[model samples]
Target: GAGVSQSPSNKVTEKGKDVELRCDPISGHTALYWYRQRLGQGLEFLIYFQGNSAPDKSGLPSDRFSAERTGESVSTLTIQRTQQEDSAVYLCASSEWTGRNQPQHFGDGTRLSIL
Candidate 1:
């Protein structure tokens, strides 16, 4: 793949509805990350996945948010009982490795709106 690819470029849902966002990482990349960006705030790291290692879920704001990745391929982020505050652009990124300085490629993101 050329880069990280996120599906459903945009989404709109009711406050209590649930939504799922998908991401496809570049082939061979071993590190994947999920982030959320509010209207005027900086990107907030949501979770991270590294090859065969335990995923990092500390960044998830609440129990309603979760993510899963199989191997080094696709990832899905699920949000339950969505809230207005959860509305934002969900960005997915992938890197060749999981290092502090490794360069990561990002997808265009899924713009989520909660009504």
Candidate 2:
């Protein structure tokens, strides 16, 4: 089965531009999450979606960052008005809902560069 898939392994854009990153979770997984890892920084949880409930967006740095997931499958994170500070590797993960004990499987991530 496909572990996970993220688009544009790398992305480069100018300030004030927008970029959309996509993620595809493994089949039958019931949990999906998005995280960002800046240079030399640890993973920061961005958003999480489970089933069809509202997404948890508390980790979003600003209104410029947003993400959505459909049922327990694909997800997309959109970064609007990109800024140099927003440049980082955006990672997506998914796993079975066996509780916190179940580890998340991550994608290679989308490296965004704001120039």
lDDT of 1 by residue, 2-93 (tens): 87899999999999999999999999999999999999999999999999899999999999999999888999999999999999999999
Clashing pairs in 1: none
Pairs with steric clashes in candidate 2: none
TM-scores of all candidate predictions against the true structure: 0.98, 0.95
Score residue 19 of candidate 2 by CA lDDT.
93
Off by over 4 Å in 1: none
Most accurate candidate by TM-score: 1
Which 10 consecutive positions of candidate 2 have the poorest summed lDDT?
Answer: 93-102
